[model samples]
Each structure stands twice: as structure tokens, then as C-alpha cells.
Target: MGRGRGRDYTGRTMPSPSSAIRPKRGKKGSETPIVTPVSARKRVAPSRQVVRGDRGVKVTRAVTIRRSADELYAFWRQIENLPRIVKHPLTIERVSDIASHWAASAPVGDRRVEWDAVIINDEPGKLIAWRSREGAEIPNAGTVRFAPAPGDEGTEVTVTLEYNPPAGKLGAWFAKLSGQEPAQQVTEALRRFKALMEAGEIPTTEGQPSGRPQNTKAKRS
Candidate 1:
């Protein structure tokens, strides 16, 4: 029966030794393995673009006020007094020593948009810087600096600001397209400051009540 089975199996040929055998291993259990093809990696750089505006706008305005540095700095240092001079005065509510909340209305196209800013840098008689708070509708940062003029007889005040309008690119484009002037605003504020300082009086807040009585009646004789 074994001979018959072998004769029948002979009709089918077996696989070659080389094809049927497994890869041999090295003596120390280390064997040469098949190598995988490595893919090439390319690095890409990110583009630098302003999310609000293509390029930031820097506004600088300076004026030589006929006042001493101390006087100019004194008035400018009072952030709460800004409304008296600033063309677009905003209500500033002090929150702490280093921070204050601000609400100002800024022109945007045909209408105005309200912004809430937070005071950042406050150096008496020197500089004041502020930016919009976290949840403000419009984002902006502005600085006001006071320095003595060359002659030391007058103060040279400079104002610089970087604001991201509410409308984003559209607002920036509109501001550029409208040709709306900033000089007038700056000049007006300076004029107001000059008037206030020269008059030797700071503007009074309407919210405060006068200590004197509105009217008094005389006693009948």
C-alpha cells in the first residue's frame, strides 16, 4: 500500500529546496533583515500675515505746547482726565492701580463702534499706554509721551497708536480709502489741552455734585 501511494505521489513534483526553505539565522541570534524604503520629508515655513490688517498702521502726532514739561505731564498722566482733551473721549472706570476699564466710541465707516480698552502702562509725567481688554469689540493700543522741547521752555507731546478696527480688513481699507484726516483730531485735542492748562483749571465731572446749595432763601425781618 505504501509503494502504491508513493507511485501516485510521484506524479506531482515537489517544490525546490531553495524555494521551500526558510531564511537561515546567524549563530548569535542576529540575522540580516529586509530593509524598508525611507520617505523624504519636506519642511514648510508659515506665512507672516496680520489677521486684522495686512500691515499695521502706526500713527504719530506731535505738538509743541506752550507749557512746562511738568504741567503737560501732569495733565496727560491723569488718564481719567483724557475725556477733557481727547476728541473721542471715553468713560474710564478705574479697576485697580495698574488697570482701568475704558469705553470709547470710534468712527468706523459711516457709523461708530464702541471699544473697551484696558490701561497697561502708567508712568506719571512720562508715558501712558493702553490696549483693548480681552472681550472688547475693537482691539487697539495707544501711547502718549511727554518730553521737554529743545529750548526747555515748552513741552513736546507725542501721541502714537495702533488700532485694529472692528471691521478688520474692510475697516482698514475703508480708513485708507476715505482719506479721513487725523491731523484735525490731534490738533483739536492739543487745543483743548492748551485751553485747559492755560486757564489753570481742569474740567469738572458732571457726575459729581456741587457742595454749595443750588439756591438759598433769606430770613424775613
Candidate 2:
């Protein structure tokens, strides 16, 4: 037979030379045809990480505001004011002497999740801390500290946070990809806080009178 154009041994239409077929054998005796399907094979996702301990990723940030230590501390002391400066503003539902209930937008893999946290360490204007209490899509803990700048009239605010992301590599991957890097978020928040405090206005809520006493409690350096 005069070399028929792209004819196979069975005399059926054959694929072009550019499109060749290679057969692959599988672990089983059956041959797994290596034909390239019109559609690609679905990717296999990497396994997720399991939760081990209560410990989470820790991050810290510090910034100096133009306001005095007393002013900054006073503003921070009001748990209700958190939503004004926090990257993801949170609503304070219940406030008490030592504890508060909060709801805020939190981060998840490529998404924003809502969570509820309970205030833990409430040392007035000096320090405040909270942990995920309920409705926590991503478990986390946070602390804010206020101090006086050395030799300067300004106030220095440091914020520390730890988060236990959802049980998956996706969580870890997304955490790294988050726009609000924990440290950067704190720094930017402090900067915004400084601007807002200097302007005598809280970012979200109505401007309140600003003559509160300084918190003299001890704070970390």
C-alpha cells in the first residue's frame, strides 16, 4: 500500500505525527493508557497540617504616637474603641471590669472570617489581652501594651498577637500571603492611632472628650 496518509495498522485514522501516544503500565497488571485526555488531570493537593499545641504564630509591632502616654493609653483602654483603629475592626458587645465580648473580621485562607473573642488580661490603660472565646473560625490571641517613650513626650504602643490557623497547609499558606502582616498591621494601626489621636478624633466612633488620666500600671519594655 502506497504509504496511506496517516493510516494506522488497523487501517483506521491515526493521530498526526505531532500527536503521538505512549502507553504506561500501572502498579497493577492492567496497562494504564497514557493517552493525553482533552482535559488535564486534576492536581493533587498537599496534605494539611494537624494542630499540635495551644501555641500559635507570634507577631509583634511597635510605634510612637504624637500623643502622650496617658492619651494613647486612655484611648486603648476603651475596648469599644478597638474597631476604630484595628485593621479588621471589631464590635464590642459586652464590656465589664475585667472582661469583654468582641466580634471582628478575622483572616482565613484567602478569605475573611468572623470570630468572637473574650477579653482576658485587662489591665486598664497599660495592657489588654484577649483570646478566642467562641465563633472563632481562626483561633487567636492578642495583647496591646502602652508605654512612655524614653526622653520623648510621645507614647509608644506595642501590639503582640498569636494565631492558630485552621488545620491545614492552606491556612499556613494563606497566612503568609495575607496583606496585613501581623507586625505591619500593628505598626500601621499605631500610625493611624497617632493621627486620629492627634486630630482628637477616633477613626470610627464620634469624637469623645480627651481629658483622661494616665494609666500608671507596669508595662513590658
Candidates in order have lDDT scores of 0.50, 0.52
Candidate 1 residue-wise lDDT, 157-186, digit = tens: 766554443467546643553234333355
**Which pairs, if any, clash in model 1?**
none
Worst 10 residues of 1 by lDDT: 36-45
Q: Tens-digit lDDT track for model 2 on 155-217?
A: 667675556556575466435644424444555566678778887655555444444443223
* Model 2 CA lDDT for position 8: 30
TM-score of model 1 relative to the true fold? 0.54
